[model samples]
Every structure is written in structure tokens, then in C-alpha cells.
Target chain A: MSATPTPSPAHAPDAAPHADGTSALLHAEGLHKTYGSTPALAGADFSIRAGEVVAVMGPSGSGKSTLLHCLAGIVPPDSGRVLYRGRDLSALSDAQRSALRRGDFGFVFQFGQLVPELTCLENAALPVRLAGAGRKQAEAQARQWLERLEVDDIRHHRPGQVSGGQGQRVAVARALAARPSVVFADEPTGALDSLNGERVMQLLTEAARDSGAAVVLVTHEARVAAYSDREIVVRDGKARDMSAMAGVA
Target chain B: MSISHTLLGLLETGPRHGYDLKRAFDERFGHDRPLHYGQVYSTMSRLLKNGLVEVDGIEAGGGPERKRYAITDAGITDVEEWLATPEKPEPYLQSTLYTKLVLALLTDRDASSLLDTQRSEHLRLMRELTRRKTHGDLADQLICDHALFHLEADLRWLETAAARLDKLAKEVRR
Candidate 1:
């Protein structure tokens, strides 16, 4: 793997900050991190405007997931900065960041990670309940989201009783129930077949757009990336903006 | 789609008159443009002559007698063979976009604007498709997906072409 550094002048650390007039909801500059001998990110710069859907795509082990984690404040970069709405994320303590994540950032993972023991409605309502909403209110919000995703019939069934696609729909409903400002979905459709994957992607993007939330989606599939407003390709821990070439098709 | 094979396949369900065949075809596949009455009658007559179809019955109608056609063994075999064979993939190497690129270069026109225009058009169509997919039924969703995938490919090509415009211009000039 010949790792020639990519020149990303537009997102350089010293470049004009928020030059796009405060529309940027999330930004990362010169992010570098390493786990022992393996470097996960090497000066990767990224940013997404409000309500935009950006896809982070690369081959396996190319730091796409790491970039997502860093931007979401789940993992701290050893060097460089991450900003959410112009505030540096590195300055926040673990608890504050955790609270921020719980309240403002929604996440959808490849396997859904829904609690098998909990019913679909409960799983969807968990985040809202964690944010201190009453059980009734949380469940009501969850039910509305489930209906939006067209999986309201499975509200009473546990995750174990639902198919993989239905489980992901429930997961998506859970992710968006809080109306998070940003949604980080890491291969949300990876476990499903093509038809099911398309359905999930359509529903996810539409719901996110309707709520005016920015999305940072990580996927290696071109078909999935097509749904996003832009794509950033990570190579050898370096993020390259491919969106400029296509201008969000 | 093969018109004769489609007609035969429809007959496989049950015998139908020319008018009924046209209605069924329009309902299933020809929603955009229904088949002409003359075309349907001509196809049925040709199929009967080729022994792929046999007249099952003739019924008195308002004007002319209506002939109901049924698929024979040969027609059934033809439909099966057609279904089994894969359609040829059209690569479209010399599409209109490519022609326009070269023409712009030869005429010393601004090729970049052409690319930008095409990109916008592709994006517009994609937005339209996304709307349709969101509201469409399962079949409509599938159709929109097919078109969206192809348009995505076209957008990628347009971007790649725009990136190589300078080099292409030089090559074309030489």
C-alpha cells in the first residue's frame, strides 16, 4: 500500500474556518490517531454542512469507521481537532461528550445492536427514555417513527422475532426518534440483501432529510453511496473528498 | 421485449381475443404506450400463420367476428426459450454524451459547461426518481431503482470526463 499523501487544501488546519458561512454542522481537521503500531487516521480532514448526507467509503481497514468514530466524539484523535457546530469536541470531558452523544447524535450500526430481549418499541424508545423522556412519551415517539418506517406492526415483537431487515428498520426508528442533529450510520444495510438494503437506505435518507439532520454514512458500496449528498473516500488513513468531482448526484 | 413471445406468454394463461390481448399487454407492460389495434391483429394473424397460435373459437361481436387465440406447443416452447436467454447488455460506448464532448473539443467550444449541464440534468433526474421511489409501489420502486442506478453510472462518467477535459482537449486538437 503506497500511501502518498493527498492534498486537501480546502480542509487544511490553517484554512479559513467555517468559510462556507456557518452551514457546516460537523468538521474535522488534521485528525491523527494510532492504536499501537496501527495508525487508524493520518491527518484526515472532513466536514459536512447542515442537513447533508455524506458517505465515507473505502476498502476494509482504510480508516473510514475510525473517521466516523472520531467525528462522532466516540473516539478522540491523538492530534488535530473535531468540531461540532464550531465547538471543539476534544475540549469536552468524557461525560459531557457522552451526554452530547446521547442527546444530539444518533447512531445505526450494521447489525442493529438492538437488545434481543426488548420488544421493538422498547428498543426504539430506549434512547428517548435515556434522555429523560417519560416512558409514555418515549414510546409514543418510537411508535411514530416505527410507523414512518412502515414497521409499526412489529412493535410488540422482540428483536429476536423480527427479520434482519425489520430489525434494522427498528434500529433506524430508534436512531431518528430523538431528532438528532447528526446521524452516524456505519454500514446500516450491510447485513441485508440488495432489495432490503435499498429499502432501508431509502427510508433512512428520506427520514433524515425530512428532519433536517446531517448524516455521516460509512459504506464501501457504490450503490449505497449514491444515496448520499457527497462521498469521501478514505485511503490508508487519509480522507479524500470525491464529492467535488461529482457535486452530489 | 419480443412482441410475439409476450403475446404467446399471455395466451399461456388462457385463450384471449386480439382486443383482450391488447388490453392485457397494456395493463402489464405497455402502460406508457398501448398497443395499436392493427398491430395486435397483425401479430395474431402472423402467429396463426406460423402455427405458434391456433384459433380456439370465433364469437359473434358488434362488427366483425372475434377470434380467440391460444398458444400451441411451439409457441410455449418459444416463450420458454426466450425467457431463458439473456438479453444483450448495451455498453453504449459512443453515447451522445461522448459525441458531444468530442464535438465541443473539435469546435473549440466550452466542454466544461457541457459537462456541468449534463451533471445538473442527471442530478435533476435522480431527484425526480428519488421522489417517485419514495411514493411508488414495489414495482414502481424497482423500476425507479433500475433507472437511478443507470443515471448514477452516467453521473460518474460525466464527472470523470470533466476531470479529463484538459487532456482530452489537447488530444483532440492533435
Candidate 2:
């Protein structure tokens, strides 16, 4: 009754890199997470160097999002170590982790998540302001990012007033405005049409690269994943890196 | 990509020399694979023999004589028929990948890994096309989009096949 195919050289475990992730900006080892008897992540290992865009790809509920949360320190893994620049996330205090997330990390979700009451410029400047910068200085930084994302004209408009594409660009501007070292984007283009999606990805990746920010992109779409430098495919709570397997034919 | 038909259709716009025809085709349809001079001349000669085009005039150029071609009435009808006729859809029911998968399963090889490798290769090409599309002109975008869609369709099929691999392996083994 064994339906499993025999392992070949292409499937050799050695093809993947060691989980220690010595030089990675963000690294996770043997991560395990569960919620109410449902296992979200069994044992996933991941790593991303500075300025590298890595895609996390899997089917629905395949622990890709869980891996991202753990990597970003939003959700602590039950029994694993997530290290950011040699500092373990689990060892950090709540306030310290929050500071790290705000100061060193940026985020973009499927929905732009721009505050309805705030104008786009205000929304983009929120991160800079959170870091205790003055209002004028924060808005100036946000203004530069908005112009780079090509949504500066709509800076005064509220999130509800702009098109989906423009709103997403504004979201991107917000993410990059803070000058974070890493950007965690979960389905950043999922809500836009093809043309819009392409534009968003182009801007997001280009801005991230220009600023030397690593991107942990989580997506199920191959087209979206194409923007990444490489991909990690998560299935049944385990993660597999596909970059090493590129040599296979 | 019927070159003769395309050449004839281009001639419909107006009389054009062999050199002009090549430039037109390359500008419009030849983003990746431009028409060689030999190909253009050969296609034009074929069309002329078929009475779809006639030599309107000849220009004595510095290098050689350039014959200007104009589409005949029959050429217009041909172009019209080509435009109206729907191209046959490629089913690819017996694709090489399917054969390779079945063979891998029959030989007790790692079919799952094979699928993953293929998926990676497909995505690699897709990434290249996406990069080109990002920096290319409108025509380049359109052409890349067509390829990207087809590759996406193939990827979708690959995912489905991966999910059903065990069932397929069982069936094929039985």
C-alpha cells in the first residue's frame, strides 16, 4: 500500500542549507505552533539574508502565514527559536519586541489597511510618527515615499477615496517610509487586478531593494512569487526551500 | 503564425518593398523572433507564386533591385478568411510531462520531487518574463502577458497533478 515514490538525489536533504542560518538577518529553527488542537506549524525552518526577497508559498492553511507570524515575532512559536541578528525573539520582553517590530520591520497585507479617517499621506506618515519623529519631519519622509510610489497626488485623499491600485501604492509608501530593515508582505497584491498587481509588485520590490530591505513575501500565486529571489514551499507544517533544487531537470 | 498570410495582410495596407515588409513584421509581431531577410523574401515569393500578391514596381537600390509587392484581390480574401477562422486550441492531453511522470512512477523514482523541480523551472521562466514585462513596451507587455497566462495555466495543472499524484500512481501501477 505504499504509494510514496523512492527518494532520489534530487530529493536529498543535503540539497537544502543548514537551519543554523549563520549570516541571515532573520532565522528560525525547528519552529512548532498549535492553536486549539489544530497544528498550524509542525516544524518549519526558514532564513532570509538582508535585502533578499524570499517568498513563502503553500496551499490554504498550510502554515505559511504561521511561519510568517513566527518569523516577524507577531506569534511566538510554541517550541522554537527565532533569531534576529543573533538576538532571540522569545528572549525579548514584550515592549522590546514591539519596539523591534516598529523600528526594524514593516508590514503590508492583502488589504491596504489604510485608516479610513486618515488621509493617505497621514496614513503613510503614521509609522514615522510612531517612532517619535516630529509631525513635520514624519510627513516629509512620507511625502518622499508617496512620490516614489507614484501616489503623491492622492496623498490628501482618504483611503476610501482612492482606487485599489492607488491605495496599495500608498500602503507600499507607508511600509517603506519608516526605513525598516525587513518588510513582511502577506498577499500584498491579492486585492488588485493583473495590471494593478504587477505595478504594486514592481514598486514594492524596487523600493525594498533600493533601500536594502529584506522582503518575506507570502503568497499562493506563482506570478506573485516570481518577484521573490527564491521560494520556500510549506506543506503539512513543514517548509522546503526550492532554491537548492533549481539544479534539477 | 502563417508568415505568408501575415505578409499578404501587411501588403493590404499598401504596396511595400521586401525591406519595408520585414521592418513592419518585425516591429509589430517580431518581439522575440524577428523575421530574417531570407524568410521575408521566401514568403513573399511563395505568396507571389500563389497569385496572392503581385509585383507593383521595382526600385534599383545601391545594393540590389527591390521589388515592391501589393496584395491581390485573392490575398484580401485569404486574409479575411484567416481573420475569421478560429485557431485550433492545443489540448496537450498527452504532454511529455505526463509521460515523464508516469514513467517516473513506474520506475519507482521520486515523482514528487520531479514535479517540484518542474514547477521551479516553470516559475524561473515566468520570473524572467515578468521582469521583461515590467521594463518592456506595450507590445512587449501584451506578448509577455500571453505567455505568462499560458505558463500560469500549466502551473495550475501541475499543482492539481501533484495533489492527485498518489491516486494516479496507484491507478497506473494497478
Task: Give candidate 1 regions above 4 Å deviation.
Answer: A1-21, A246-249, B1-132, B144-174
Q: Write model 2 residue lDDT over A1-249, tens digit each, in one string.
A: 112111123212222333453777888889999998999999877677877889898888899999999999999999988988768999999999999888788899999489999999999999989989999999988888898888989999999999999999999889888888889999999999988998899989988877778899999898888888888888778888888886522
- What is the fnat of model 1 with respect to the true interface contacts? 0.03
What is candidate 2's CA lDDT for residue B9?
88
Question: Which sections of candidate 2 miss by over 4 Å?
Answer: A1-21, A247-249, B61-65
Lowest-sum lDDT 10-residue window in model 2 chain B: B57-66
User: For model 1, how does the per-residue alpha-carbon lDDT over A82-197 read when each residue is reduced to its tens digit?
Assistant: 88878889999988999889878889999948998899999999988998999999998888889888898999999989999999999998988877878899999999998899
Question: Where is model 1 chain B poorest over a 10-residue stretch in terms of lDDT?
Answer: B57-66
Docking class of predicted structure 1: incorrect
Q: After superposition, how far is residue B81 of candidate 1 from its true place, in Å?
A: 7.2
Q: TM-score (0 to 1) of chain B, per candidate?
A: 0.89, 0.93
Q: What TM-score, computed on C-alpha atoms, does each candidate reach? A: 0.65, 0.90
- C-alpha lDDT values of all predictions: 0.83, 0.86
